[model samples]
Target: MLRTGASRLALRSIAGPAARPAAPSFTPPLQWTSRLSSMASRRPQLPPMRQLTPIQGAVLRRAMVGKIDRKAEDRYQHEKLEPHPELVTTTSSVRSAFSEVATPEAPKDVDMMARVKYDFTTIKDTFDLSAVPRQAYLIGLAGVLPYLATSISTVYCAWEINHSVAGYGYFLSAQTAEQLLHFLEPLQVGYGAVILSFLGAIHWGLEFAGYGGNHGYKRYAIGVVAPAVAWPTILMPVEYALITQFMAFTVLYYVDTRAATRGWTPSWYGIYRFVLTFIVGASIVLSLVGRGEVADHIKGIPGAVDRMKNLKDDAQQALSHQEEGIGAQKAADAAKED
Candidate 1:
């Protein structure tokens, strides 16, 4: 009994715990089971694909094969056309076409003689002298008279000195010749400086008048410097002063010409200035020559008077010789007649 009991205990220990039977699950309804069975039996059917006709299939295939990006198409077109870039007519072509029409033909014959012989009156007319005001002419003539007077006085002084005359019975006298020249030299120098200053001041006036704009500074500088330069020339010798003045006048005329060319002055201003400059330059040269001639005569150098005496004596001798020759010719003719 004890052994059977021990064997039963060992069997129980080896078996550990006895399995309990699972509680009976509740059965679904007959309709539910039939629905689940039908669902299980029926395989899910996919949506039918859209049917394509032969033409449609061909279009689809072509669309897929021939799919072109717009940007790529444009790039391809540009590349394809780039090699033939000269297809379009350029502006050069158009210009060349019109160049022939615009070009003038050369003359078959040229009349150079006729061109040379062209009337000078036409050029004179172009200057429009009539356009110059009466006041301007009067003022200009009045201004020139002083220069003329000085030149005449210079010539007279030279003449009187050469002839050893004491006086001209008018303005010039041998006693006053040196004094007169000294006075005239300073007078000319002062007048030239004044005129140069006046010329420079004109640019200042123009500047103030609003015509100069940003260029007024340059004009102002020139105006100030020109007068300053002219004033120093007066301290030089009389001949040098005159030469300096002459050079200043030339520079002023050049400036005036450039201004006139650029339309800074009146249209007739250039011609007017030219005329005045010519007169002034001539007077200066005359004064210088007269001074030289007078100096030579004062030094007792052979001069105009001596040359004149020689010429006169030669003329008288020639006339006497001619009369003698004529008398001899008459005598010869008489002898031949006999």
Candidate 2:
């Protein structure tokens, strides 16, 4: 205020001719208040404003200036103005899986396929089973049981026969066990043929019903092909028979899927055929593997099995023949001497 008044008086003296009472120095609408400041406690009392000369008033105004604390001002701002609203922090706890086994983490750089142990994608891809009738679905699954049973039984019988012939142990006499093992092979092969024929006959039934539009001999040919392929396998060696049936099942399964795709069979037929064929093929492999030893032994000899019992019997018969010749020679010598 004093600086303003002094500046005004100096301007009035300089422009005495044109100056009117200096219009009150312009005041701003918003007055600044120092909320963080304080006045000095001890101060000199001033004479009345009217009695004071201009110099005295100036001097008194200068003496009255309040001191501001820089530290206090900064502290005030830090406490009040800077932290008007506080920040909030939130945290979440996630639950883990309950299994004891820890999951293996996949490589970040590798594709999903690279992490897989088995390449089963081709077999895994099959049509949905919902389209097949419940009865047919159940029965179709049941059809592979004979293949499964024969395969498993053949392996057990083979092991028993082999062990028995070796004098390791016997479930039955060696002959019985051998017969039993041999018995399983023909059943497996003949059963495979019958199944193949039955599956082909389904196409025949479908054609007769004209479930899909007749395509001349195309469908009939499919029916004939399965039985043709199946029957020849019965005459094959056990190993060859099993391998042939496996291939036949696979090929017919492909055909069945193609028929389904062409709308000749229900959409579910492909999946049904896939399941049955998978089982049958596995069964054939199992049977072939079980008979592997028989295959090895039978080479260069037709239906010949070497066992301890057979060897012993041959040795005993030769010994008796030698003893008889020795007795006959002694008698001839005694006669010649007489």
Candidate 3:
């Protein structure tokens, strides 16, 4: 029994505080402490942030903070802008800006005498007569025959009338001359108007040929109006009508010359027109001179006046002889009665 008791005491001492209950205190439980220690070991730490110094803060402010103030300083500088060299204020520079650099000189008047001489000298060289077709020349020459014949007949008629009146002492009673002249004068006027209208038709033809547009129509209109102007003048007296025809020819010549100058017609056309118009105008003037009243006025000049005075003296002598014969007959009858 003593031995068993001693063994029990030794076992108790060895087993020590395990047989007693644990007191609750601030100490964590073993499972919780173990979990916390494991989490602390796994977690990552962050680095510390650094603070800026005063000098660095000042530099940042200067570089970025006051840009508006710096721009204001740049805008209002003291120096003036340089002017362009061409815009300098010298007299020559100012004059060059205002004055024209390449103005042409005014045209001088042409010397008419020199022009005439030049034309005469260069006629054959300048004019290529062969360039005109043979048919054109022949037709143009044939057209002049009417004017020539009419003019010649007029002058002959005038000469015959003057001879009859002055030599035979009375006007010619023949109606043939007057009738022919009356017929021819209107014929000439009508023919002239027809020719003028025909010239206008040439413009219309040109318009249709290629120049068809507003300008061509305008040319045609001018031609039409020219003929209308000629038609009304036909009703005037023969002399006045001839004068109008002359004026009309002059106007046509001017217009055609301008047209030729403008390259609307062949170069030689102006010369041909001038020649034809001259002949026509001369014929008209001759016809005018052949009128009876105009011829009488021409014959009233010095030589014709002397011839008329001699005829008057001869008539007076014949009348005096007739009266002397009548008186002698009367005196002889009276003597027979006594």
Best by lDDT: 2
Tens digit of per-residue lDDT, candidate 3, span 145-209 = 68767776766656555555533413443344555555666667767777777767777776666
Query: Could you tell me the lDDT of residue 59 within candidate 1?
Result: 43
Candidate 1 — which pairs collide? none
lDDT of 3: 0.63
**lDDT (C-alpha, whole model) for all candidates:** 0.67, 0.70, 0.63
Could you estimate the TM-score for every candidate? 0.49, 0.50, 0.47
User: Model 2: which ten-residue window has the lowest total lDDT?
Assistant: 86-95
Ranking by TM-score: 2, 1, 3
Candidate 1, superposed: residue stretches over 4 Å from native:
1-119, 165-173, 212-214, 297-338
RMSD of each: 29.8, 23.0, 31.0
Which of the two, 1 or 2, has more lDDT?
2
What is the alpha-carbon lDDT of model 1 when measured against the actual structure? 0.67
